[model samples]
Target: MDALNSGKFAGFNLSLLKFAWLSQSFGGVLFGFAIPMFAAFVANSIGGKLAFPAGFIGGLMSTQPTQVLNFDPASLHWVTTAPVPSTFIGALIISIVAGYLVKWMNQKIQLPDFLLAFKTTFLLPILSAIFVMLAMYYVITPFGGWINGGIRTLLTAAGEKGALMYAMGITAATAIDLGGPINKAAGFVAYSFITDHVLPVTARSIAIVIPPIGLGLATLLDRRLTGKRLFNAQLYPQGKTAMFLAFMGISEGAIPFALESPITAIPSYMVGAIVGSTFAVWLGAVQWFPESAIWAWPLVSHLGVYIAGILLGAVITALMVIFLRHMMYRWGKLLIESL
Candidate 1:
């Protein structure tokens, strides 16, 4: 009794932490794999283009077990299946509900020791999984579908205008903040369109990778052009770290460079991102996943074009940085004596 009241069995029970882990694992399997795979099977049966990859992305965005019966892959259906809800509403509901249910049951229920052990280990998990599936199917899936439809419609309209315009807008948004609210907004919209419209997401992926990589290249070029080490360290590990982070689709890695030289750095980063994004979109490179990073490049529809776009952006940004710095030095704006 004392232990229960105080939440201590040598320490506080940390029941919430345990519950969170369980919910995440369960949700990942349901939302990330099982449902998507099933959707793909259904789509294939109907001769639809919503393949496994696209269905997986749809599941990822929806995070709910939708009304499978209403799905008509032949028509590329979405909202017809259900209405939209908040992002990841299904996952959130499932995790929270499952966690709380287990917590409450553990605290309030009592049984024989052996029975209790079995209930805790097996019965609870199975019951929770079923509950989540049913809840998502009946309530959450419709709303998620609606929201996905809206996003898809908007992006589709944008794509129709021209790849260059859409790519420039997305890339600029990403580079403007690195990983701030602007970046997140663009990312959310892009991610939601991964299944139905891959261009926006593909452009975003390219934009995400260019800034850090371009800045890293700039550091190397700066050293070469000036014939001196830019930083105190001989190897410049920060540049390497930036490149690594870029590969992982983290744009924040370039924040330090932007802060140190905002005038030159920010413009260069934006320009590079725009170029890469536009080129990738023009090449019709499609990414099924939202932010899988460079390691997932093989998943892109046009691998060669995607790589070419990345290289072009990185080279352009590096050159721009080098040129700006050289001009600054010649004009006496830069006080460094190394050159």
Candidate 2:
């Protein structure tokens, strides 16, 4: 816990928690309530012994066994032949719509602090529930079916290489912003793809680790290669903090580096990340779920190659930053000594 409370770690965790809490509007609450309601509703819709095995979502709800859906590819329709686990589908939509609505509302209307929280509390939950009702019977069931088909089509068209590239692209986006929306969206999309076996969790795992590790190495190498004091002052701790967070897939880890030298750090990190993600895809490292970087060892199908990808990315970023820092330091020192 102390580890979590200090430096960049504290900041990153707090940010993620804030996002997760605010995510209540995005369907976290509604999905909590909707699953049982969905199960009961579905059971009633098609009466029979349809078993919807409870998973993580259901575990949270502490609900009974529900029905799982079995879709008919021949007719492109879910026959309602069995109850399906649409709970996640229900929640994801709720989260997306709710998240967007909250963002819109926050932008359009500003209220007192109490009023804002109250409004968020009441409105988001109600809206999410309503949205779930609309989506389950009408939208998600069909949409999910479409997604399955789309995945199939992509598999047929791209074969293995193409799909791998898509995952790498997503990793690149995540690496670009760390914890920003683009990063979140890419990570979320990648996880969803994992569920369908389209992308491995390891692919994302490597992606998230790249930014911090890359930047951290750069800072370290800078101390030796160049006389630049990028990490020589108070900034040393910040770089270390970033490295720790990045190990856990915290992209915000790179924020400090960016703040210090937006002109240089940003591009160096990006290039390094691109290199890392490319290797991950090329090596075919498969992952199963999204996890903190501490769990990286267990997450990958091929750990050795995955670690190598991360190391390569780090080296590239370090070298790039070292080169730039040395140039800047030399010029600055030259000017200072002349003065």
In each prediction, how many residue pairs overlap at the backbone (N, C-alpha, C within less than 3 A)?
Answer: 8, 14
Q: Which residue ranges in model 1 land beyond 4 Å of their true spot?
A: 1-81, 84-162, 195-200, 226-235, 335-339
RMSD of each: 16.9, 13.3
Off by over 4 Å in 2: 1-132, 139-148, 230-232, 326-339
Top of the candidates by lDDT = 1
Cα RMSD for candidate 2? 13.3
lDDT of 2 by residue, 1-339 (tens): 333355555567777766755764555445345444444333323322211211222222222113346688999988654322333343344344434443454466667887877655665445434544454446555555466456647755887777666756766777777677677656555654554565566656777777788777775666566654454465566678888887666768778777767666777877787777678667766667457476657747777777788888888887887777667766773121110
Per-candidate TM-scores read 0.55, 0.60
The CA lDDT at 339 in model 2 is 8
Give the candidate number with the greatest TM-score.
2
Q: List the residue pairs that clash in candidate 1.
A: 83-142, 83-143, 83-146, 84-143, 84-146, 84-147, 85-143, 85-144
Least well predicted 10-residue stretch by lDDT in candidate 2: 47-56
